[model samples]
Target: MVISVKLLEGKKVAQALDETMAKRVESLKEKGITPGLAVVLVGDNSASAVYVRNKQRRAEKLGINFQLIRFEESVTEQELLAKIDELNNDSAIDGFLVQLPLPDHIDEDKVNEAISPNKDVDGFTPISVGNLWIGTPMTKPATASGILMMLDHYNVDLDGKNVVIIGRSNIVGKPTAALMLERNATVTITHSHTKNLKEITSKADVLVVAIGRAKFITQDYVKDQAIVIDVGMDRDENGKLCGDVDFDDVKDKTSMITPVPGGVGPMTITALVDQVIELAEGRING
Candidate 1:
């Protein structure tokens, strides 16, 4: 039986999230407690810069307090930590994030650990990671949270399903697997060193690909009627945005799938803003 994959468009999902955020922000504004997000960008990776800029623009359009801080590649690690310290103590800054893929000399883990958990809206801190594992009300990594939101939006039942997540990165793969487990899905995590990857993926009721490679998963790796979630964004040979899975090849074999560029990307940002608002509200009431 040939299955036609239903497209899970992220733009639509993101718009819905933004609308909800707008209403929540209005409520906060009326209460005279505006939620603020501070984004710190180190070095000048063109892609990272563009992402930060887009985030700032979106935050402004939504009337959320947004601040962007840029630093040169030569900036010292201590300097970056100091800035984070300042944000941590600043009551006006509800949440903040330090952009990823920092320079070689800087320890990413150290920086992530330095951010105060309450202000760590990026959800990269150890405390936040622990909260996610314990199923507490803490900010989760936006990408992981977005994937969960997408599943909920589509009404995908996760109870007792077999979920196979490719890649074991902390940002997306591992946290997502934990979340799936939380929803009662039997989760399996695969990485580069895993054996018989195709065999594992073929058994999955839900397949999430985040290996960060271009068009890596083909038709053979997917099960018939499996829900495929592509979390990778890569530029193809023609400079078109493509996902980790070969969309054309796998579309007809899956029950539903998320499209690249328009799928997981937008939802990630939306989830970040959502968490920020949630944090602000919780802080005020608690």
Candidate 2:
């Protein structure tokens, strides 16, 4: 029996979200409210720059206001906090985020904490994360929300299923497990230290891989027809982009899977944009 696989493309899911956002933007504009998103990018991280550019492009295309606040690598932490404070009070600003991986001198936690939870569209603040974990979500972490969108888009049912997630990062892995559990699936989180990782992963009815290593979960780690979602954006030996799952090796073994460039990546930014709209509408239910 030859079972065909479904590739869950983020581009398509993002397009669907784009249409929804466009309508919402138009409605808000009629009421004299233009949703705005401010992104604070510190230093010169190439990956962060690319991500910011992608976000600005998408925002502009949707007619949403996008502000890119650039800071030098040598900028002081106090300086960033001051700027965040200003944006917090700015009435026009609906949502904002400080891009991660600040330089060694700055405290990432301090910056995240400084941003008003009311304007914390990144959903990294203690208040936001806490709200999400307990099920009454005010705002969700973008990547995790995006993963849920993928599951919904592909019609993958999670109820009563064993969902295994790799890499327990705050932004992706942990929040995703929480979201899956909200959907009634039993979730297990594994990291670098887990014993017999494959033994654990192979038991999953749905597998999500966000471990930083490129192409880490090959065919052996997955069960037959299990839906796979790759949350990694990594480079291969040839300097080409890849994901946490080895798409070439594992695609045929799954019922559905998300690819590297077009998988969870696009949905993440889209989810961020959605938060802005939700904030403007006074409907921030995560």
Best by lDDT: 1
* Candidate 1 local distance difference test against the native: 0.90
Residues 67-168 of candidate 2 have per-residue lDDT tens digits of 999999999998999999999998788988999899999999888889898889888899888888889887888999888877787787889999999989
Off by over 4 Å in 1: 1-4
lDDT of 1 by residue, 1-286 (tens): 5445689988899898788889899999999888899999998999999889888877877778998989999999999999999999988888999998899999999999999998888887889899889988478888988999998999999999999999999889989987889999999999999989999999999999999889999999999989999999998889888999999999888998999979999988888888888877876786
Q: How displaced is residue 40 in candidate 2, in Å?
A: 1.2
Residue 195 of model 1 has an lDDT of 89
